[model samples]
Target: MIEIKDLHKSYKMGSNELHVLKGINFNVAEGELVAIMGSSGSGKSTLLNILGMLDEADAGSYTLDGIPIKNLNEKIAARYRNKFLGFIFQSFNLIGYKSALDNVAMPLYYQGVKRAERTEKAMHYLEKVGLANWSDHLPNELSGGQKQRVAIARALASEPKVLLADEPTGALDTKTSYEVMDLIQGINDEGKTILIVTHERDIANMTKRIVNLKDGIIIDDSKVEQVKASANV
Candidate 1:
């Protein structure tokens, strides 16, 4: 479903180029759940941003569901991103004044969905995340876990082909983190491709495969997890 070859990304840092990604070759098949794990400054997040089309790759061949995206103009990239992918971030990225339902509906609003239709569709996703009752509550009224659930709901409400989660369980207690992971696994089982970037080894092992990065390079990838299911948390 996704393919990236010989990808390179660099940023200017005080006259020295910070070469974040050095020839990353990535591939994700449909219905697969993959976790990207790496240390700080290892370029995991940079890779995620490039995969999400939020950041430009200095050089690469990238295709999503058969459409080449390596050199798309910003406008075309944004259109493809909104239509084909969803993003959930570490920060929960919800509007403070909006209710959970409204926040989930926001993406559809930008996509030109009618107000009533968007609300109803957003509610379905909210319920899927087990937050239907909290639909009317604002972000401040929810726990960190609930806020993240709302973020996931918002991401899923767009009905994109893939979900990109960056540090998805980073800002939660142990219990809440596992809850979120279970929720994400459920979503993955329903056939949406999931790509997650996380620093936690435990969380990475919860997915179908775990890939490790170092110095902007993939050092390891495993289809069989070293972590047992009983210790998913």
Candidate 2:
């Protein structure tokens, strides 16, 4: 469902350039749960950003479900991003004042979904994430895991083709992190392509495959003997 070839990315710092990704190449198929593992400066986040269309690559190619993702105007890129990619961040980027239900509904509202339909869809996703009872709670009112669950619901509310999670379980405790991974594994079982960017070895083992990155290149790529997060939980 996703493909990249010879991807290269760099950032200029005054007279010097910091090369983030160099000759990266990989592919992800539908319903596959994959984790991109790397250390802090290994370029995992840069690769994820490019995959999510949040940033452009300096060279090479990226194809999301067969569409070339290069040189598109901002409007079209935004449209494609909204239509195909769903993002989950470590910071749980929810509005402080909004309730969980409303937060989940925000993306649909932006899509011009009517009030009734969006509310129904949002509630469905919230319930799917086991947060229906917490709908009226605000971010600050919920625990870290709860807030992350709300974020996951919000990401899924868009019904996008790919789910890109950046350090999704980074802030939660071990049990909570395993629980969240269980939820993500369940989602992948239902045929949605999921890509998680995490440095934790145990967390990466929860995914079906692990792609190790070092110095901006994929050092190892292989399917793993999936470890059940539910067992750990």
Go through the candidates in order and give each one's C-alpha lDDT.
0.90, 0.94
lDDT of 1: 0.90
For residues 106-199, could you state the per-residue lDDT of candidate 2 as single tens digits?
Answer: 9898788999998899999999999999999999999999999999999999999999999999999999999999999999999999999998
TM-score of 1: 0.95
lDDT at position 68, candidate 1: 86
**Per-residue alpha-carbon lDDT of model 1 for 1-233, expressed as tens digits?**
99989989899999899988999898999999999999999999898888888888888888899988877789888889889999999999999999999999998998999999999999999999999999999999999999999999999988999999999889998788988988888888899999999998778878999888899888998785534334554
TM-score of each: 0.95, 0.98
